[model samples]
Structures are given as structure tokens and as C-alpha cells.
Target: MLWRAGLTAALVCAIGLLPWLAHTDPALTVLKARSAERTPAPETLRAIRDQLGLGDGPLHLLAQWLGGLLHGDAGRSWVSDTEVLPAVAQALGASLLLMAGAVVVAVLTATAVCARTLRLGARRRLGARGPGGTGSAVLAALPEFLVASVLASVIGVQLEWLPALGWYGPQWMILPALALGLPAGAVLGRMLDDLLPAAFAEPWALAAAARGVPPKSVARQALRRCVPGLLPNLGLFVVGLTGGSVAVEQIFDIPGLGRLTLRASLAQDLPVLQSGTLALVALAALVALLARLGVRRLIGPALRDGALHSLHRPTPPAPRVVSLVYLLLLAAVIAFGLPRDPLALDTTARLQTPSAAHPFGTDALGRDVLARIAHGALTTLGTALAVSAAALLTGVLLGLLPRLSGPLVDTVNAVPPMLAALLVTGIAGSGPWTPALAVAVVAWSPLATHTASLLRQERATLHLTATRALGAGPWYLLRHELLPAVLPPVVRHALLRLPGIALSLAALGFLGLGAQPPSPEWGLLLAENQPYVERAPWAVLAPAAALALLGALAVTAAGGARLPRRRRTPTPPPAKPGPAQPPATPGQPHPARPVALTTPTDTA
Candidate 1:
């Protein structure tokens, strides 16, 4: 709780300092946003500065803003010159609705998937393969932005099924909700699927089945047991939805907090930006608190009784065929894209359909689509790899020191990658490195959490105790036991997260917070060609296809990295039946038996 409060305070302070840190004049930026003219008269500049209190300095202005916030005041926006609280409140309400709808959709989708798997008796089969298997991987890999673009183009524009542009009614929320929910649902379903087998394999579940309990009843019981394990991640998903919806809101033109925050940051509207950040941070903290309480209520007894030792099991590697297929597709994309010049433009062939000269069709600028995607692979994929690798290394190291990393992880994890990108852009200004930097800030938390949890389990093993008793030094134990035991799983976690990191980068690029125009980045390609969707759909499909392929490859490859499972403890021989004690009187307690306890060995 202290950490959450501190994180919220820190973020609010950081947002307040953005104008100062960026070394730009907030007044000038606001003036430019207000008018088309780049330059304004001295009188106008002075008037604007005076009105917005720019001369008060960032500290004094921030202090004044904070003072006002204590009494239900958020000040007024520099851009609109209206009460920031009301505008922020409206945006927050919309975002809350969107997030609530997305969460409901995600929960239902996951429940349906898990129910199907359990009904088909595929729990063990799917669990062995990990998560939702290949299908979920494909679904999870689809970025929200890409999904939104396709849905808006096909369902909104082509089929005329729903209004995708505005948020007038509940009907307007469906597409954006689905776009956010489906991918999150895939992820949640996979996680639940991975956990179901364990629940079903429990002794209680086995006894119920042996007693001829209905399959449906047993399945319900199993789900109940597994849900507690998923609660933390569920909270994460909700918090993530708040930050991840920025692009979706923009695509749908919803005046949600994310879109509002993005606009305010760009325009240097400190009041609006600060208030939005505070709302998001508060939402995250509340979610975290509720999730913690829920998990404790559901699973606390089992943990206290030592009935549950660990929530995670070792994930098996992907099938050879899947890995091979992913590699082949990746190689094919590279082979086709590397040879051509992405920058070579021809006005004569602009917006041409896919042909012998341009396999992926030309964009508005007549540049080779295939060539740009291939080159973009370097920028997008390369950065993702670098960020993932860095996160892996950093997470493993920090995870070894759980005490030091715990608070940091909790605080950083509260801020989603999208929110982090907004903050980074605000501080440093948007550039090629902004996406990578922003992603790196939030990417380490998951891996660190995984490693820290695994480390705790590993330390509790008898083997580790014996090794320490034998005078094995910390470094030796870390190298031979801890690192060996921890690295593979942590690396696998990082690999599984690779696609998401890449997607975040792409989303940022799509939002114009990444590489500028003519860079051929995949996200930028989608954003650049969105307006010409009807003219040439191929331009948009090409990059979207490339991103999807990359996601599939990462998921498949990560699935192929297996971990050595811990050896199970051997069940002790049944003790000779002891003579039953006489029943005690109503007020007297029964005598306790002397029970032997044994430490479990760890032989991974």
C-alpha cells in the first residue's frame, strides 16, 4: 500500500515536471496548438503566459495545482481553458466503461475457452502444451491497434455492421471493446488452461470423480480452485486495459482518459495530463488492492495449511512442426524483403495493387511495401529483441535479490507500457528510442516476478539447504544451482513476452510516438496507410501480416524452451493402524498424535 501510494505520488510529480524536463516552452506549445499560425505577437504570448501562469515556474504552479486538488479542484486546461476536473471526469467515466466492458468480455471469453477444454477432457493435453496452445498464441499475438484497424475497416466501413468512429451509444463501444478484450481473453484463457490440469489432478478432484460426481460439478470445483491463482494476473489485465486502450480509443475517436492524456501531453496541457495520470494511477492501486484481497480470501487458507506449494508448473516445449513452420515463414519474409529498396519511390506507380514489381503493393508514396516491411523488421524486431534481452538479464539479476526488487517491481508494474511511453515522451520528447525506452521501463516486472517466485520456491528445497550446509558459497550456488534452475524458465517467460513488447512498440509507433514518417516501421506503415484502406487494402494488410507472423514466431519459439521439472516427493509407507482412542467427554479435547514431518527433496 505504501509502495502504491509512493508510485502514484512519483508519477504525479513526474507528469508535473514534464514541461520543465522537455526544455520546451509550455506556453508556446499551447499557443501553437490553439492557433494555426506558428508565430504569435508578443502581446498574445504574454497574455497566454499570464493566463496559464507559466511565469509562476513549474514548482510554484505544481504546488498551486496540488493545493487546488485537495479541495475537489483540478484547475483548468490550458488548451480548452475549462475546468480540468470535469473534462477529466468525463474522460475517466468513458474509460471506466470501456475498461469494464473489456474486462467482462475478457472474463467471459476465457471462461468459455476453459469450459470447452475441460468438457473435451483436453485439460491435461492443453496444459502440457501450455496455455491456449497455438490458437491462443495467434490470438494473443494480434495487437489491439491492428485488430481495431481491421475491425474499423471491415466491419465498420465495408460490412456496415456497426459505427466504429464515435461513442454516442453502447453500440459504439462493441468494436473497441472486442479489439481490446479478445487478445486479453486469449492470454487469460491460456493462463487458466495451463492451471486447470493441476486443479483437476488434485486429490480432492480425483476423489470427487472417483465417487461418481458429475463431470460438470467436478469441473466447476476445479475452476474454483484454479481461479485464485489467476486473480493477480486478472488485476494486471485490468490495469493493462486502462493503459493499453490509448490507441483503441484514438482509433474509435472515444474521448477516453488515454486519448485525452495523449492529446494533453502533446499539447503540454499540464492540468489535464496531471489529472489523467492521477486517475490512472489511482485505478491501478485500487485494482491491486482488490485483487490482493480477493486472492487472500480465496486461497489464503490453502496456503496457510500448506496444501498448495506452488501456483506454476513447468511448461513443455512447442511441437517441432510448429517451430519449423514459424522459422520458415520468418525466413521467407526476410528473403523477400531484404533485397529491394524501401525508399525508392515512383510517382507513376503510386497506390498500385500487388503485382510482379511490388509483391505487397505500393503505398501512398509508391514505395515498395515488401521492402519497407523487411527494413522495418530491423527497426521493430531488432528493438524488441534488444528490449526483451535486456529485460531478461535485468529481471534475472534483480530477481535474485528479491528484497531489493520487490517494491520496485510492484511500483513499476503498476504503470503499463503505454502509460510509460506517454511519460517517456513527455520527459524526453518522442523519438526512435522512445518506444524501446518506454517498453524497457515496464517489461522487466513480469520476468522479475517470475524469477523471484521461482527463487523463493528453490530456496525452500532441501537440496539448497544441504548445499548451503556443505559450505557452498553464494556465488557457487547461484552459478550451479540457482542460475541453472532459474534461467531457462525466466528466459522462456521473456520469450513469451517478446511479442507483447513488440506489439507495444508498434502501438506507440502507430500513435506517432515512435519512428517518424518514411521510416517503414510496421506500426507506422499501418498508421500511414489507414486513410487509403479502400484504395489499396494490401498496404495495411502487409504490415499487419508481418507483425502477426513475428508474434507467432516468438510464441512458438518460447514454447520450445523447456524446463526441468522438480522431482516429486516419495509417499511414505502407510503407518501401522494405531489403536483408536476412546471418545472424549463433551468438554474434553481429544489427545493429539505424534506426526512425523519430512522435508521434500528437490532434484530438478
Candidate 2:
């Protein structure tokens, strides 16, 4: 709880200090927003500064803002001069509603997916191909923005099934909710599927089945046991939904907190930004608290009685066929995309359909879509791989140091990548590096936590202890023992996370926080061509397909690595001298020789 409070405080403090840190004058932004045509004189700037309390230092402003927050006063927006509380409150309410709807959808979707797997009796081992298979992987990998754009284009624009934009009524919420929920559902469902087999394999579950308990009842009980484990993840999913809604809200034009905070940050509206940051951090903390409580309540007694068994198992290797297919697809994309020049322009050929002359069509600027996507493969995939590799190395190193684990990991993990990107953009200004930097900041936590855990476990093993006692230096032990044990799993974890990192980078781009225009980064491409969807749907679909394929390939490859077989220590040959003692006594058991008990100090 203290850690959560500190995290919230730190984030709020950082948000308060953004204008100063960025070395930008908030007054100028306000002035620009108010009257873009007029230049600000010295006197005008001074008047605006005084009105907005810019003369005060950041510490002073932060203190005052915190005090006001305690008394139900959230200060006033610099741009609108309106009470920050009401605007923040309204936006928070909309965001909460959207999140709530998404949760319901996620839960239902997960349940359905899990049910199908359970019904088929496909209780695969951990890390093996799950029941949902390729379809679920594709769904899980699809970014919310891409999903929202497609839904908006096809279902909203073409089919006219629902209101594509706005937040006028509950009906208007459907598309945005679906966009956020579907991918999340796929993820949750996949997690549940991974967990269910272990639950079913437990002794109690086996006993119930042996006793002729109804399969449905046993499945229900098994699912209940698994839910506690998933609670923390579900909490994270909720927090992620909040962060992810930035793009969703933008696509749907909803006045949610994500959109509100983004607008406030870009405009340097400190009051609104501070309030929104508070709301987001508070929401994350509260959800985490609730999840912790729920897990405790559900598993407390079982834990006390030692009734619950560990759900963790070594992940089985993915099928060879999956890996081969993924490689082929990846190779095909690179082979087809790399040779062409992405920058060539021909205005007369703009928005042309896919043909022998122009393979992925042209954009509004007459830039070849195929060229951009092919070139974007280098930018997006290369950056993601580089970031993941750096993060993996950093996480492993940090994880090896026991002092750096625990609360720090928890605190840092609470901040989502999108939120971090917003903070980074506020301080450093957006650029191609901004997204990568922000992602790298938050990406190391999970790997660090994983490494620290494995390190602790390995340190407790008999062989490591023996090796340490036998005068093995720290570096030697790490090189021969710990690193070998830790690196493989951590690498696998890093590989699994590569898709998410790529998605986050793309998301930042989609939100205009990454790779500016004409860069042809995948996310930027999607953003640039969104308006042309009605005229040329191919522009949007091309990049989205590429991103989805990239995600699928990464996921497949990560899961395909073969599990290493456990090595066994050979037993020492029995002492030949025992035969002499064995001859001693049929009745008297001989003169019992004093047996010496010795601890084995040899590491090998």
C-alpha cells in the first residue's frame, strides 16, 4: 500500500514538473490555443503568466495543487479557465463506463473460449499449442487501434451497423467497447486456457473426477481455482484497457480520460493533466488493491492449509510446423518488401489499386503502399527487436541483484507503456526515439522480476550452495550456473513480449507520439491513411495486416523453442568394502561400526 501511494505521488509529481522539465512556457501554448493568429507581446505574456500562476516554482505549484485536491478543488484549466474537477470528473465517468463495458465483454469472451477448450477435453500442457490455436493468436496480437479502425471502416462506415463515432448514447459505446474488449478477451482466454490444464491435473480435481463428479461441476470448481491466479493479471488488463483506450477514444472520438489527458499533455494544460494523471494512477492502484484483496479472499484458507498446488510448469515446445510456417511468412514479407524504394512519389498515380505496376497501391501523396510497408518493416521490426534485446539484457542484469527486486518492480510495473510514453513525450518531446525510450523504460520490469525469482530459486539449490562453499567466486558461479539457468527462460519471456512491445510502439505512433509524418512507420501509416478509408481501404489494411503478421510471427517463434531436457547427476558406485561388513552377522549384526556422516562439498 505504501509503495502504491509512493508510485502515485511520484507520477503526479512528474506530471506537475513536466512544463518546467520540458523548458516550455505554458502561457505561450495557452495563448496559441486562444488566438493562434496573434503574436504574444511581453506584456500579454506576463498577464497570461500571472493569470495561470506560472511565476510559482514547480514545487510550490505542486504543493498548492495537492492541497487543493485534498479539499475537492482541482484547480482551473489553463486553456479554458474552467474548473478542472468537473471536466476531469465527466471524462473519468466516460472512461470508467467504457472500461466496465470492456470488462464484461472480456470476461464473457474469455469464458467462451475457455469453455470450448474444456469441452473438447484438450487439456494441453503449459507452453504447448493452446486450443484456440492460430485464430486466437491472431486475435490476441491485433492492436486495439487497428481493430478500432477496421471496425470503424467496415462495420461503422460501410455496414452502418452502429454509430461509428461519438458518445451520445449507450448505442454509440458498442464499437469502442468491442474494439478494446476483443483482443483483451483473446489474451485473457489464452491465459485461462494455459491455466486450466494444471487445475484439472490437481489431486483434488482428479479425486472429484474419480468419484464420478459431473464434468461440468468439476470444470466449474477447476475454473474457480484458476480465477484467483488470474486476478492480478485481470487487474493489469483493466489498467491496460485504460491506457489502450487512448487510441480507441481517439478513433471513436469519445471524451474519455485517455483522450482528455492526451489533449491536456499536448497543450501543457497542467491542471487538467495533473487531475487526469491522478485519476489514471489512482485507478490503477485501486484495481490492484481490489485484485489483491480478491485473491486473498479466494485463496486465503487454501493457502493456510497448503491445499493449493503450484500452477507453474515448464512450457512445452511449440510444434516445428508452426515455426517453419512463421519463418516462411516472415521471409516472404522481407523478400518482397525490401528491394523497392519506399520514397518514390507519383501524384498522378495516387490511390491506385493493387496491380502488377503498383503492388500495395498508393497513398494520398502517391507514395507506394508496398514500398512504405516494406520499408516500415525495417523501422518497426528492427526497432522492436533492438528494444527487446536491450531490455532483456538490462532486466537480466538487474534481476541478478537481489536488492533491486521486489517493491521497485511492483511500483514500476504499475505504470503502463502508454502512460510512460505520455510522460516521455511531455518531457523530451515526441520523436521516433520517444516510443522506443518509453517502452524500454517499462519493458524491463517483467524480465527483472522473472530473473530475480529464478535467481533466488537457483541460489537455494544444493548444487549452487555446494559450489559456493567450494570457493567459487561470484562471477564464476554466475557464468557457469546462474546465467545458464536464467538466460534461456528470460530469453523466452523476452521473445513472448516482443509482439507487445511492437504493438505499443505502433500505438504510440498511431497516437502521434512516435515517428512523425512521411516516416512511413507502420503505426504512422495507419494514422495517415485513416481518413482515406472510405476512398481507399487498402491503405489502412496494408499496414494493419503487416503489423498483425509481425505479431503472429514473433509469438510463434517465441513459443517454438524446444524445452531442454533435465540433466541427471550420476550416482557414485557403491563401496566394495560393504561386502566385508555384510559377512559379519546373521544374528549379532557384528560389532556395529560407527558410521561417519559427511556433507558433500564437491559441486560436480
The TM-scores of all predictions, comma-separated, are 0.84, 0.82
Best prediction by lDDT? 1
- Tens-place lDDT per residue, model 2, 1-604, is 5755676688789988887776788788889877789888989999998887789878888999999989999998888889999999999899889999999889987887787657643232322334446555567767787789888988998899999999999999889999999888876776677667656665565555545666777677767766765675577678667754788998899998888877787788888988887776777667767876785676555544333454444556666687688778767766786787778888898898889877788899898888888787787888999999999988888888746444455555545456578778777787769999888888887678667655654565556767888999999988777776667556755775676677678668766777666776777787788788889989988887776676666566655343466576999999776444445656553454322211111111
TM-score top scorer: 1
Scored by CA lDDT, what does every candidate get? 0.75, 0.73
Task: Indicate the residue-level lDDT of 544 in model 1.
Answer: 75
Query: Clash pairs of candidate 2?
Result: none
Please, what's the RMSD in Å of model 1?
Answer: 6.4
Candidate 1 C-alpha lDDT tens digits along 401-507: 87777566656765546557777887778787888988888888767766775565455444667788899998888766777666765675577677778767776
Model 2 residue 452 CA deviation in Å: 9.7
Clashing pairs in 1: 318-559
